[model samples]
Target: MGLSMFALSRRSDARFAPARSSAELPPSFLGSGIRVRGVLEIEGELTIQGFVAGRIAALKLIIAPGGRVEGDIVAREVVVSGNLNGRIFAPNVTVEETAHIDGRIFHNTITVARGAHFDGRMPWRPVNFFETLDQLPETQP
Candidate 1:
């Protein structure tokens, strides 16, 4: 009876376990001085401490302080604390105090710290269909 109960508990735990998706993946890093000059497409989160000269696409991206990326970035979320010189497209973007970005940003939400510097346009948009619909002109039925 005890063995059966233990098995049932294990099965219940398995059923309630968290799903493993790209968004849940841990952050990965690129060491300094290593330069990537082509497109980077990642299924999970990534952190760059080196230099990249091409486009980056990921579920989440973080540019650590002292890192440099000179290409476009498209991700679900992005946190920048380094130097970026290309366009950024993310649902949420946070630029830390030490960040420097020189490209346009297309984000649903953006946060910039006091010491952060951004020299490009930030085009705000809604992340959900409902929010987008709310912004449209009302039409008669």
Candidate 2:
């Protein structure tokens, strides 16, 4: 038995839009070599390839393979492929092969590669505390 052309054509549908150039994308780059002596706050996704010596807060943080940070980080998600020497607080944290971390980590999910060197205590915490509490039995006051 053989399949008909209509069977393959059925899977091809206009479900996705066309691609756009980098210029058409949103303002995402915070620029490389961002030396911040003070706090570096951001509301959107940020990719760092420089040296930071202060607090960093963003929606999503990406530490490039050549990036280095010497302060704390608070974000929704963090991807580290460089060097970090401070505490990290996020819901999801990933350490790639070139990553090196020497601090504590507080997150719901954490990934460490084989070549990654992380020498710190990772305190696991539930992501949904309210949901867990709601599932508990009601206690009489």
Candidate 3:
């Protein structure tokens, strides 16, 4: 009985765990010298230590310190530790203490660290909203 309960707890925790633990899978890294301007799509985790100016679709995304992104991001999980200047459509988001964020964040759950700098709105959405997000939202002029 105790073993069954332990298993159940582990299963539940998995639902809220990071997309992939560093030990389980290596994250694709973009170095500081790189700069990109286009749509990037990835099925696994990605970590950015450079400059990006476009859309990103991934299972998990991390903007490392000193990195910058200027576009939209759609992912299951997002962790920002640098600068972001656009929207985020994710079920879970974590804004680190060094993060600088502007624009909107649409998330089912979000955490902004004490030292994070933010200048935008965070709209809570149901998980179903993300499930149907096949494309980016049209811009409003």
Candidate 4:
């Protein structure tokens, strides 16, 4: 409803690219058995139930229960119901009660449910901060 994802994609080819419509390719799901190391770029939704160590850029990212991710994440929307040990740069974020997080969160809007185990900082930022993110900052600010 704000700036178009398509327009933003054009500026971030390293992590954002055109993908088939979500209707054509269903949301990607990483199972619990999988462990990945690299960049995960998606135009649609991505549900992670595995272990990942790298960067992730997506329209929507959901860290499912039992999942664990370590690194940076840039997305329009992020919902954490698992474990995360990195930074998140997103406009909207939801941290479920089952989430176990340890890192920084930079969001325009955020909701953290009761019982969530988080050990880090949550920094509020303007929405424009997400639109212009080209690389992960060398240090958490």
lDDT of 4 at 119: 96
List where candidate 2 sits over 4 angstroms from the true fold.
1-27, 30-32, 128-141
How many residue pairs clash (N, CA or C atoms closer than 3 angstroms) in each of the candidate models, in the order given?
Answer: 0, 0, 0, 0
- Residue ranges of candidate 3 with Cα displaced over 4 Å: 1-17, 20-26, 135-141
Q: Is candidate 1 or candidate 2 better by lDDT?
A: 1
Ranked by TM-score, top first = 3, 4, 1, 2
Cα TM-score per model = 0.73, 0.69, 0.82, 0.80
Q: Single out the weakest 10-residue window by summed lDDT for candidate 3.
A: 132-141
TM-score of candidate 2 versus the correct structure, residues matched by position: 0.69
Q: What is the C-alpha lDDT of each candidate?
A: 0.75, 0.69, 0.85, 0.83
After best superposition, candidate 2 residue 118: deviation in angstroms? 0.6
- Top candidate, metric lDDT: 3
- Using TM-score, give the best candidate's number: 3
Candidate 3 global CA lDDT score: 0.85
| lDDT of each residue in 21-106, candidate 1, tens digit only | 44467667898878889878887888999999887877678999989999778766788999999878776788999999998888
Evaluated at residue 71, the lDDT of candidate 2 is 83
Ranking by lDDT: 3, 4, 1, 2
Residue pair clashes in candidate 1: none
lDDT of 1: 0.75
Q: What TM-score does prediction 4 earn?
A: 0.80
Per-residue CA lDDT of model 4 for 74-137, tens digit only, reads 8877899999999998877999999999999998788999999999999998756776676436
